[model samples]
Target: MDEWFRSWGLLRDERQRTVFRRTDHTHLAAVCWPSCDADTLYDLARLAAVLMARDHEIDTAPPEQSISMARAFRSEVSARYGLGGGTGADPRWTPVFSELWHSLSTRRSPRFMDRCLATAPTEFLTGCLVYRRRSGNATEADELTAYFSTRRVTVAQRIDHLLAEASLGIELDDEVLGDPLMSRLLDLDVDRTILIQDILSAPRELAAGESENIVAVLSAALGCTTPRALEEATVLYENLTDTYEQALTALLGSPSGRDHDVRAFASALNDFSTGLIEWTSHSVRYTQAETSNWTKPDEIVARGR
Candidate 1:
């Protein structure tokens, strides 16, 4: 872990390192990766470390610079094996990806490995960059949610699809990939783990000039007032929560869910969502302002710029 951290001055900023140590993702990881074998956990940690660093790079950088990096990223990653640095990529992080590429060469199917290890992260980091760029300007809730799906595909693919096999680790062929129930479980995990943050932090986020909040995006999209958006976002959050519970129940009842390995995998994924909910509810990160009623997500008020 220390070696990977040193691969590219990752967490080099003392302030960032401090924040990384206590990052909410770490809490989420604690829930998901606890039972993974050493190697699997190691692989996940390395990938996440780089992704998180890259995500934070944009977060901490000036807006123009982040936009520049986002625009330059496609060209930069296209030449991952090139010897020289391109426009936006850090040369040092190249080696990090290079190392992972080599390690993943045998562990996963070549194409799946390529997309998950290479294409998915690029897509996800690109989405994050675009997110920062459009944070305050987004008017389409569907588009915002699409970007949110990138995170789900990236993280869940690592754990469920890649490591857990077709049905969260039951090892069915590619056929199971089309399972709608599985897709629902995956999406529920995503909104549960990611989107809820937007609703809970709407106040602080709006004050900071970021409109990434679900409420803000819905407000703009629905052409409604801020309070109405908040109410709707709360309703949406509740829907997401309810859907998560139902999907998880169905996951546990499916044939794949009958497998011991799949059960554990699904359970870990569920724990991650629940853990994040508990953490977000109490962590100073979102509690900077008084929060809405936990039992009633609809009660949360929205803040505006």
Candidate 2:
């Protein structure tokens, strides 16, 4: 392993001995590359850990300190890439490494930060750390739990606020959580939800008149659907919206409303919901138990395209 990996405690040998649990989808990495060697995967894992730690640090840091630290990190990364005055390192790293670093380092841009935090490394790391606490080294796990608990809750609240603003929020109360079908909805990544919303909102901006094509590309990019949703993709999204809203209303013990566009955001996330379920079932970002009970529908038809 390289010094960076060792310094971050992501060494492959060490990981093998420990219960290195992880459950967040590195969507960018999956979309960009088909596969990688063990070393590359370990590097990505380590980088993920570091990025997640930095996320908590930035979120809890005072505004001035956060901004300053973000700029400094950005500058440091840019310098390594020869953007600022400094000698650049060898360009031997995999493309995923570079992409992940760019996403993690773009703290100055809220849009970029939103995208990163949407499927942030911290989310996955938090899941893993919690899993470890329940299954593996307690003392080590407690340290991680203590360090990240407050930060995780803070970030989650921020995300909840964003979801509310977007009208995509649902009360994750005992009633909702107790329902097996409803609770899985919480797994929906806020970043992906926003991306889907943006694409569905202004499809032409992304693909001119080929909104369906763009949706297919997005579905493929997200690893949500295979054989592409194609001509039926638009109809699928619409069906998803209506059905999702209905499901949400039922779960929330509320009635559906006429202003469907802004209420509960259930419809806006039909594609995302479907894709997340499909993707998470097989993705390494979730545990087998989490997906074991998932029942795939025999058919996924939408209204006539």
Candidate 3:
């Protein structure tokens, strides 16, 4: 696993190396079977690399280059696994992929979604497939194929949504999983995040329309009048916005700032101090949007490209 990742140029430095070591579950029987063979371990490593690539946010090769590289990877893994036949005969096309596939495909599991959102692009897609599979009852293989078949634009949009949630630095409490106020709070935070992105990404000063949008977003999000109304919602949005601004500023002002930016943001957000607004956007358990019927899973599959 380590060797293969190194070949992919994945473990570039001590930090990445440390993360690899930390996440490596080869020794854990629950993650890897007690008698799992080296071949299976290598396959798992490849799958992990595919899933976790987005977390690193490495610039990947273009499609043709990526396809060529993936082909080479498949050949190498197949050779090692002693399934040297080409194309459909390759071992990866077999049920061997299903074993790991089932494990990676999570349902409405918030923890699993959180982990997926925190991962890199490839893994994020894998996470989405898991969601579609578990929630919509689609086959993992079909969804995986459909995902790649879709246009890069759709995939890019999906990644953007996942990245937003991953950067939000919050999670939800099970007790308030179905609370409408909590959902509204999350929706507000999400809108705030979108507005923040729009403001930061713009080249010129905020337009009158954009300015109005900000005020509207803030008005909807920040409960300006009463700190008492939804106390948890109020405080949670405050800390979340604080973290968001600091992280955004740090990224824009100094790209090479300290390594603890995310930690600092999380600390400021203080989710642990109170579990009120700990919900993340990826939590199927929580509704982070004003309207959940924008698109259906099958529709995404049909016109995803």
Candidate 4:
């Protein structure tokens, strides 16, 4: 992974290299993208970097400059990739993107890529089929699940895993395990994650003067104190977890062959959801980086256990 960044010109210097190393994306990718082979991970890492360049607000640049940079980046990326029309992106992107685009086009046709870019672009770019979005912010849980599934991840490796394990056909392209019961299982899987992330990242986000978090949002919506909000959120997490386990139990206890494919897919999804919780619990991505010296990757990065 570090070699990819180094050779692709993404992490050009020692500081950037150090930061990339400490980020420890490899662990998370391995966990969440449970079905990814070496080639798939390579694609995921490369495209994830491109996506984060303008999407993730990592820099403390002034709002205006940041917006300007994002617009230029989007435009440049669109123009270069032929996603749509735009001009005058950062010149540095040209070489890196050209190589990426070349390799991508060699594997897949431009028209197919355009279609991929049009829908669930992140899944295609990242080459992971574990479908999710951090969109559990809703007054009700079921509503959030249905709403979020509309914009689900649509990559292919999860398909690969399912096909390999359950011997499923391409007819089941949709990632919901194709039923309401399976849908609820996934909703619970993601729901606890948002709650956990809300609790964990709330400190850093509050320090940065942000409150688009479950703890803060729930506090405001429920008219409760912060402690009450945290408590309620923890209860909700436990409840969701219990229900999800029950759902898994119900599925796994079936007589035989009733929902085998869905069960197999659910296992992979469990790996993804639970793996994310473990990885983030160990990583400092959501935590304040002040305590640890990030210059040392081994000290800071939460390696796979």
lDDT tens per residue, model 4, 140-225? 32233332343233212322232222212212234444455655655565555566666767767766855456666666667788
TM-score of each: 0.68, 0.27, 0.24, 0.61
Tens-digit lDDT track of model 1 for 82-160: 3234332556566677676566554666566555545645665566555555543543444555645544543333343
The local distance difference test score of each candidate is 0.57, 0.38, 0.35, 0.51
Clash tally, candidates in order: 1, 2, 9, 0
Indicate the TM-score of model 1.
0.68
Tell me the lDDT of candidate 1: 0.57
Angstrom error of the Cα, residue 144, model 2: value is: 22
Q: List the residue pairs that clash in candidate 1.
A: 164-169
**Local distance difference test, candidate 4:** 0.51
Quick one: RMSD of model 2?
Answer: 18.1
Model 2 Cα shift for residue 167 (angstroms): 17
- Name the top lDDT candidate: 1
- In angstroms, the error of model 2 at 228 is 36
